[model samples]
Target: MKLKMSIVDAFADKLFKGNQAAVIVLERWLDEKLMQDIAAENNLSETAFLVKEKNDIFNIRWFSPLCEIDFCGHATLASAFILFKENEALTSIKFYAKAVGNFEVYKKDDGLIQMNFPKREPVKVQEFPNELLEGLSIKPKEIYKNVQAYFAVYEKEEDVLNIEYKSELLKKLAPYDVVVTSASKNREYDFVSRYFWPASGGKEDPVTGSIHAGLTPFWANKLNKNILVALQASKRTGVLFCELKEDRVLISGKAVQYLEGNISV
Candidate 1:
């Protein structure tokens, strides 16, 4: 069998700067194992498989090499990029993930794709796990947790940049990952973050738009502003424009296509 696929550099203005996601729009859902095998074969952080449900609504699922993911921002944005590229008149699309309910994505006049995700505001955690403490070179000043991962708040942007991860110790956190973040020194961005998910997709995510749902609200309250800009401090860094809407966060970024081809199974 043959299938069409696209590799997109999401959250990037230009090629090779952002996280890469493999997107496959299918006529029907493939077997669960097939999808997982495909993700492993593609070897990207996340491979998004989309099946059209209606006029502009589609069922989307993401898989990593190791396992399936509940939520994935970059891959979703990549899927939207494929859809919009196919139909330029399309201004908006709704995606339904089995794990996370329906969410909307829009193509703005400015050419960025905006996603509306639930506000995943994390609560401060008074206790710390030994694994978390031992995994990093520099410890965070405070820690918080939500459904996705543990949020580690640092005092300076330098701390965020300098911290090193002991993947062995960090992956012990399993099921949950870690986020290290601090206010950016750069005048252009509001906050900066680095994602470490030894338990999930990869060692580091080049740009993470999903985590910004939690980060946006955290920084918004910290800086006393609803609108903020973020920089993912990974080696191949990327920028995200964020807004803390009422019960949701609006995350926007640009995606560029890296490659297109056919996959045979």
Candidate 2:
């Protein structure tokens, strides 16, 4: 079978920056194993697969090389970018995920794709697991946890940047990734973060949109602001514009198409 595939760099204005996601548009759902195999072959952070349910609505799923994940921000943005480019009349698109429920993406007048994602607010944890601490070279000032990952709060941006981790130790924190973040010293951004998911994807994620959903709310409350700018300080850096609403978060960023072609399976 021949399927259409697109590779997009989300949260970036140029190529080789930000997170790369593989997006495959299908007429119908493929076998679960087949999708997983495709994702593994692609070897990207997250590969998104979608089947059109109706006009402007799609049934979406995300897979890492190892397993299926509940939510993914960059791949969703990449899918919307492909759809919008294909159909100019499409101002917006709705996506339904089995685990994350329904979400919408709108094409802003300024040419940014804005996604309305469910807000994930994490509460402070009194104690962190031993593995969590042993995995990192530096200790955090405080720690918090949400449904997806553990947030390790640090005092300085340099602390976040200088972190080194043992991937084997991080694997002990299975099913939950770790995010090390701190208030940005640079005036251009409000906060900076780096995501490590050795148990699932890899040692690091270039730019994580889902984690920012939690990061936005946490920092917004700390900074006493509703809107904020975030930077993921990985080797391939990216920026995100985030806002915390009552029950949802608005994550907006620009995506650039890296490669487009046909994949035969």
Candidate 3:
């Protein structure tokens, strides 16, 4: 089969300086093995597939080079961007997926894509395991747990930016990924964060949107505000505008379509 794919740099105001995600629009869902193979071959942080159906809704899935993820923000932006560019009639896209259960993407008049995702509420833990601590280097000021993985929060943003985890060790402890975040008290933004998923087939993700689902609510309660602006402090940093509503997070970002072509298998 031939797959038409596009490489998009999301949350980038300019080209080549944002998180890159491969967006593929498919007629229907492919076999599980084939999807993994394609993701491995692409070797991107995340590759998103969108399958359009009879109704206005579409089915979406995200895979990293190593494994399929429950949810991903940057790739969702990429997929929405592709749909907007390719189908003028599709002014807005609603995506239903198996990963995070279900999410929707809508196109904005200002040319940005917005995603509504589940909020992963994190509660404080007594202490983080030494194995997990070894990877992050910084002793977390606070730790949180949810359904998938653990989250560690630092006292300061500088520490968040300076974190250097031992990738090999972190991979062993984290079930899916480890997120380290800090309140950006010194900066204009509300928070700064990073994601390390060495266990799930990567060292450090350039920018992560999914992790923010946990962060948004955590900071929202701390800051006593439901809205926040976040910056993912990866080498190629990305910005996310977030809103913490009841059980969902509204994530907004810009996407730049860089390349489009077909992959033959």
Clashes of each: 0, 0, 0
Writing each residue's lDDT as its tens digit, candidate 1 over 62-165 gives: 99898999999999999999999999999999999876789999999999999999899989999998999999899899999988999999999999998999
Evaluate residue 137 in candidate 1 and report its C-alpha lDDT on the 0 to 100 scale.
Answer: 90
Candidate 3: global Cα-lDDT? 0.85
Candidate 2 local lDDT, 1-265, one digit each (tens): 8999999999999999999999998899999999999999999999999999867579999999989989999999999999999999999999999767999999999988999999999899997899999999999999999999999999989999999988999898888999999999899999999999999888899999999889999999999999999999999999999999999999999999999999999
Off by over 4 Å in 2: none
lDDT of each: 0.93, 0.94, 0.85
RMSD of each: 0.8, 0.8, 1.5
Backbone clashes counted, model 3: 0
Q: Tell me which of candidates 2 and 3 scores higher on TM-score.
A: 2
TM-scores for candidates 1 onward, in order: 0.98, 0.98, 0.95
Worst 10 residues of 2 by lDDT: 50-59
